[model samples]
Target: MAALTGLLFLGAMGTANAADGFQTSVPSAILVDYDTGSILFEKDADKRIAPATLAKVMMADVVFAQLRAGKIALDTPLVVSVNAWRRGGGPSGGAAMFAEVNKPAPVGELLAGALVVSGNDAAITLAEGLGGTESQFAQMMNAQAQAIGMTNSEFHNATGFADAGQVSSARDLATLAAHIIRTFPDYYPIFAKPNIEWNRIKQRNRNVMLDAGIGADGLQVGWLKDVGYHALVSAVQNGQRLVVATLSARSEKERVEETRKLLEWGFQSFRQRQIFAADKEVGRAQVFGGAQSSVGLAARGPVNLLTPRSGGERVSARVVYTGPLRAPVTKGAEVGRLEISRGPVKVLDVPLVTTEDVAVGSLMDRAIDGGLTLMGDSVRDLARRAMAKLHK
Candidate 1:
């Protein structure tokens, strides 16, 4: 099937990354606008790596889902097994909330432990309590991951224990972070707080940059000796929030610097621009056997983007849909997408919907539309062949 594509050429592209020459050395990284989910910048974003403690973001997400569903309350008590204590608590000599062995801790405290303190013990306890076993709880995590669109992520344990299967990409991690903040607004404070005390043990937020200012509010960071440091950072400047996921920084300082640099650059280099106003027709999608040959398409809301602040950028716009849609299309039905790209990076993608309903056309109209479609395709093919021959 031929896709309906509209090609557009915009003004001069700016120096946001071109003239400024922004580069990242982190093995895998992605910068995203939280509101629009735009890929502002990416470097090997899909490369999978053992996420270490970064996996806890998903663990917290599963627990949050349980809470949101009323399956568990923040005050619900979960017992810390010896296995959890031995492997994740003080006995393991890793970051832990120091939850006592065999003692029951409240779900809220455990969540605080896991998120604020990066406590493996608290995480395992919640896993065992909610799913009956850490391994089983990992299944719950996987399900939640899929439901919320963390496509390139997997889980093996509640605490980010070293497992070959426990892996995710920078983009997936950023998606997880954005999902958490957006879905669980009430519970999000735990991720930003500087400290949470559990079992008489106080641990500062593992995210070192949380209090370092620059509007760094929430998110998580992780490190494994083998994989270096991985972090998911969310920050806002001037009311625009950006989520950054970076992996394989050689040191904690490097992780903090690389992510912070990206966030600062994102805030400084981009400015919001309105493209299509709400309810305005963006383009038209062809209709087969309809009252009209094509249906007008518009976005439900104003189409806007955080584009380069300086000058016009080289942008390609396309109103893309799979087919000349079937007849009887309803108004406001999602029909296609308005894709805008800056060079190789897709900066904006908004859902395009039918601006008005279209009923089935008469047989004569249908026949003419069919003929036109056939002719269009044939012409396109012939043009491609002719161009190929000319090039040769």
Candidate 2:
């Protein structure tokens, strides 16, 4: 039994190392593989900081949900209130859509203005129209954040206008970006538009990567007095999409340059390696008191890793489970974990599940298995005692 466990450990050690060789000028940043939720690189990714305009992502997400549920329509007209005009419209001296006071605008146009040009007025109008007040809309944002597994984030406003206690992490922002892309495909193209014309004024998107011709697409950009510059840039190359979130850079140029470098490194340095196919047997575990002597273990989905382009074949993996596993075990039950590593650094860990059911053993089989398990425990105890005495 000990030898079998050792072999499982050895088998799991067959994967490449995820190295942290890249450096960035930004204080907080993260790069993720969009398809697999893999963290390619990170620097203080979970450190909560003011999100600036990036908070608009949640604002859009809430509105998008409403649209999807038929609670609102794209052409739903919103009446611009005085609060919206004063706080986010042209009067506040920040990013504004110049929304006319007391004038009605369609929801589609406001969405375009907010997503394309980061218009604060458009954000406020949408929030008030949907939630009856900006404060209520903020509650919706917080509720949505909690539902989406964004554990370390909070929302206080619709426009992300530098309010105290409004904070998010680079990782959380990246998660939001990915969610928007995956959930709202119909509305995502608005992010790619370079500019939106409203009230005779044209404002361009702050995300310059959209025009970089590197398969870049829609996301968000943000800045505040103390938060510096921040942006979430996502692009696809050769069927692979990568999202890079940056925060607290010295300038917009720094954010763009650092993000570009990180994306380039991700594309150039690593390639995806398939460890196991979906539902394919990875290994087997001894099944005590079951009709079958052993049960096959497999992953619920395809297991893939982003490994160094060169020498990626030298990776290792280990299958770890507390055993001998007692049955009856149902199919798809999580029984173990597959830990992939390279040299000394661990890269990925995925759950190992049973591939098929294992029925409870008959009475005679159960008796024999119980006797065997007792003998195994006694031997393991003796081995531990021997090792302890040697150490003494």
Q: RMSD in angstroms, all models? A: 6.0, 6.6
lDDT of 2 by residue, 1-392 (tens): 44244233333323221243458989998887888766677778889999988888899999999999999999999999999999888899988888899999999899987878888889999999999899999999999998887888999999988778899999889888899999999988878888888889988887787876667888888889977999888999999999989899999899878888888888877777676899988888777878766788888999887766654335567777878788898988998888766566555667889999999976755665775666775553444445446757
Question: What TM-score fits each model?
Answer: 0.90, 0.80
Model 1 regions more than 4 Å off: 13-20, 367-372, 377-392
lDDT: which candidate is best? 1
Candidate 1: lDDT over CA atoms?
A: 0.82
Model 2 has an lDDT value of 0.81
lDDT of 1 by residue, 350-370 (tens): 889999999997676566666
Q: Which ten-residue region of model 2 has the weakest summed lDDT?
A: 9-18
Q: For each predicted model, how many residue pairs clash, with residues at least 3 apart or on different chains?
A: 2, 12
Estimate every model's Cα lDDT from 0 to 1: 0.82, 0.81
